[model samples]
Target: MSSLPAPTRRSLLGGAGALGVAGALGGAVAAPAHAGPWTPARFKGAKLLAAPDRHLVGRFSYGLTPALAAQVRRRGGARRWFEWQLAPGRIPDPAVGSLRTWWSGLDRGAQELWSRQTSEIEYGWAVMEDYQRYVLLRRTRGQHQVLEVMTEFWENHLHVPVNGDAQFTHRVPYGDLVRRHALGTYEDLLRETITHPAMLVYLNQAVSTKRRPNENLARELLELHTVGRGRFTEDDVKSSARILTGWSVDLWRTWRASYQPEQHWTGPVRVMGFHDANAAADGRELTHRYLRYLARHPATAQRIARKLACKFVRDDPPQSLVDHLAGVYLAHDTAIKPVLRALVAHRAFRASAGLKVKDPGEDAVSTYRALRVAIARPPEGERGEQYAANAILWQTAALGTTPFEWPRADGQPVDSASWSSPSRMIASFELHYTMSGGWWPTAGTGYRRPGQWLPRRRIRFDVLVDHLCQQLLGRRSTATLLKACSEAVGVGRREVITREHDLVRWSMPRLLTTLLDSPYHLRK
Candidate 1:
């Protein structure tokens, strides 16, 4: 039986903020899990494919790169490139590593953060900004494109919003938890996330006791994380909570998952057909076994596959594609790589291109990559790096999604239509416009030597547009877009080159803003 918890903190129900809103509106309950695996007959039709490279880069990475495109070309095709991206361990992430040096707090243990100062709101936000910037830089610049994509997908799949002012400290470990198991077996990721202190408190499992079991974590594990809405019942939720009663974080061990037998409900419990047999003092082992069983459930396979297909394929992913991906996930016992490989190789994936629109975060990062915008602070060890990072975080927050900040656990939406509204579209254009003029408008496109980054020759308007089109979009400009861009800057078809820095400084931002707002840049 599905059940929603009464008015509490968060629900994470059906859609983004669905559960939270459900809680406020006459009480909350667990989501309605899928009755069965999705079928081809369910949706009637599937979206067809559009541009190949554009689709690949858009779906696989937050941003597109000439280097990333070239890598795919070298690998012979999108399928092989995807396979290669799956083995991110073999790929070095120097850009992310370099950013880490700037973010020293990321290395601090949970205990250190807890003891240092948990109540300082500004300080907590600063630490949170560092974590957010790490995620942003990695997505926008990291080499493991597919790995990053999966990281984002799994982060949302197992959403754990910040619990309080001090929980910002735990986000570091939480992000690590997601990244470590991002491409691994499903069981490992589930185990790691549930046991982590951040999730424990976020879902209220940390405080659950035998006297009063908190169903928050247990219910979501079934409804949101594993079997999904209809596969389990209310009794299973109660049982799952009993199984997890003693599973709390060890503040003594840097806030790691720990067990206190005194708090455990050692009596028998059952989640679906799996049972604990009421074996006293066996809660931990049963919890592990029960979770592993859930990991292997057929419903779980389909649930995870549908989510992956939703992310990588179309908004309403084809049920046929979901079934195919589910088979791969189940056959491999939920090892992530195999499921993704099947997804990349699927005909549905290749066909359903350009139909998906970009989310706010995706749009911002993609714009940065297309513009080759540098995310650096002032040179000579300027004191404003932290402020700069905070500024960028605020920028992304305005777009409606940033890392670790979704107030509810459902996370940002996956469908393109959610972000396609005219208000949001205009907000995106304003952001791109500001960045086009450099992060600070006064900085005037903010390159130490902007000319060096540009084409060496003093090119004419038409040639400049062509060069930028190739640079930013990886293709020649469409007739309509080229005409609009030229007209935006009052340039005639037969314009001539000129060596005028003043002209470039004055006009380039406007022209580049036009390019960024073009459908070519906006779509993928």
Candidate 2:
């Protein structure tokens, strides 16, 4: 195997410190302070705090949904609701037949047969559409919120470029790797990802040989996957790459053991301060030992804890809480369920408010979930198929979070600063308006009847506002918003009213546009 260049202190510092002032600020703010243990009495019957509610919904659920908000109120508070979400298997599965059918319809073999040649780009787009559809169904279906959230988290953690040739064909395996193991043991998930064909191709490990080792996969395996920054050296990365030599894809070929002894690195390698001392050891054994070491490292525990806390608790989670979760992770040998349990039970998790920003995926899925929109079945004709594809692709693009197509391996940032860009904000407003208006393109087979498309009777302004507030905002609208909506609906001409039969048809789009673009929506 090729030897690694020794890590320089300067290079380490440059890479580690690139996190900049934001990292320092996050670290400082995340320090624990002396707060008495939480007492339920303090929060009982208190006015619902907007900030905490927003954070709670953003993290535990898809985003804030009016039905979820009301359910929280009925159940007493966020703590109980969070506890339920952490143990997602306890909830029954909602009907997801439509979602499953949508996925099944995208089989590459069928598509290739029809198109006469396989376009990797087209296949990637189809898989991404299925992913978006599934996410939307998960939110709206209501029973699998926790599973969906965990799936998203794990997918980001083990990110593979979707555009690669092998990854394009094996997208199903990549997705299945995440979904099946999302809530299982963290170690298992990490190990599975290491040999997965998608990852091998995406990180250029497929061609990593003893003579000319590629360090891309090794670098990310530590920097992004296990220890994150400062915990491993460049020398360690190089050594790790050497140890991982001989791992290659069985693309389009039957999966026999792909490890070629002749191709393997039978040379000494040092990694993370330990030498593989047995230079001529079996390749499989060497790979297993290396992965086990990474999975069990203290740095791995810390990194995983911080990420979980950030996703479920706050933007900058309390160090004490993270430490506690890390301890749990270690004690359980990186079992995900126990760590999740500890996170849900922590006091900091319940108290932090307005700390997370809804990624576009979260925002779009949560809205559909709140509205109880079912994934529509494909119609009988070519027009129907085109419409279904177009609608899903357009919505995904509009939200700026088309699945499997993130610009970076880090996945889309979950901070408001990234998502609230001017163009993004405009897109959010437009999507909300379109959804609220029930304005599906009429040139398709999935078209709704007039009654389904828009309500027949005139909806009272006050009642309409209340329903929307309860459904979309999860709280009653402010008096100013209510007054404006009432004025807008009351002044429209009969011709206009007839043209837009539903109150939602006429007013909801404008109202939702305002709400989604509001500072309140941006905060959590």
Predictions in order: lDDT: 0.67, 0.60
Report the C-alpha lDDT of model 1 over 288-392, residue by residue, as the tens digit: 788899888889999898877777777788889988988888899879988877887788988875556667778777877876766663222334553444456
Candidate number achieving the greatest TM-score relative to the actual structure? 1
Candidate 2 lDDT at 138 equals 53
Query: Worst lDDT window (10 residues) for model 2?
Result: 37-46
What is candidate 1's CA lDDT for residue 416? Answer: 62
How far out, in Å, is residue 62 in model 2?
A: 2.0
TM-score of 1: 0.84
Error of 1 at 12 (Å): 40
Q: lDDT score of model 1?
A: 0.67
For all predicted structures, in order, the TM-scores are 0.84, 0.76
Model 2 score (lDDT): 0.60
